[model samples]
Target: WLKPFWLKGTSSSQRPGNLYSRPLPPAAMKTLHQEESIKVPKGIKVTIKAKHVEVTGKHGTLKRDFRHLPIELYLANSGHEVRAKMYFAKSKQLSMLRSVCS
Candidate 1:
């Protein structure tokens, strides 16, 4: 009936609203951008001359393709509060690659 269809559509729209109810804190994004300006860690080197940022560390150098989205990288020795953000379509594969490259 019309009631069921209306309920379905309402539920669908509400789902995303609920998921995004709490957005990323502005302070966190600001900190990330500020951190990006600093030099890479002593053991880690980052080159952002090209479209993608190239990171070289103990493991090796890895190039992350950032043709469409912005990328942010955060490196820390410990703690969950320490992290970075980048734009890469938010894919698990990209996260894995960045972590390894860092």
Candidate 2:
């Protein structure tokens, strides 16, 4: 069986930098929380912010950063599936988080 395309890193550069990086800082968490306040479609919403990514839906919100992470978004409802979209700036690999939302 083939795994989802999003599960695989889009680019080699996106791989983790280090194995022991700490969790997201308080400031990043605040930004993530604020980002999650925005409305989304009926399905679970997953937003990739500048410093982190926020997942919001019926179950609630969970935030995480790319420092030490995996490329997976698990939604509570089986009917609801995750959609991964990437927005880039000048270079394809570099993207602005806010732009991806809109």
Candidate 3:
């Protein structure tokens, strides 16, 4: 269930004389484009596949399949960061990756 809109005003904070009351100007608006990266532990090993990613750490190996996505996954920064790069991601693809990564 969701909270009612009327309750939002009571729960949210409104500071006095706040300069941020107005929204950003059109010229100040910026596009957000980010690449997701997961850190690779010192003793971990990673294998990047076209449809899946395999990671082997001190604990064990973890594999995840991303066959349906339109993004590319790889290792970066001397294999320390597992980066997910997307050329043009649909909403489904973005949400799927976000859930899995988070």
TM-score of each: 0.31, 0.26, 0.57
What local distance difference test score does each model get?
Answer: 0.49, 0.44, 0.70
lDDT of 3 by residue, 5-97 (tens): 655544333433456645657653322444778988788898887868888887888898888776667888988888876645555556766
Best by lDDT: 3
Q: Which stretches of candidate 2 lie above 4 Å from their native place?
A: 1-42, 68-102
User: How do these models rank on TM-score, best leading?
Assistant: 3, 1, 2
Please name the candidate that would achieve the greatest TM-score relative to the true structure. Answer: 3
Residue pairs that clash (backbone atoms under 3 angstroms), model 3 = none
- What is candidate 2's lDDT per residue for 13-39, written digit by digit as tens? 454553334465554211212121234
Per-residue lDDT tens digits for candidate 1, residues 1-102, read 455554565654355447664575664222222222243556776655434657778998888765553555454443222244444333454554355334
Q: Which consecutive 10 residues in model 1 have the weakest lDDT in total?
A: 28-37
Of candidate 3, the 10-residue stretch with the lowest lDDT total is: 9-18
Alpha carbon RMSD to native, model 1? 11.7
What is the TM-score of candidate 1? Answer: 0.31
Worst 10 residues of 2 by lDDT: 28-37
In candidate 3, position 52 carries an lDDT of 85
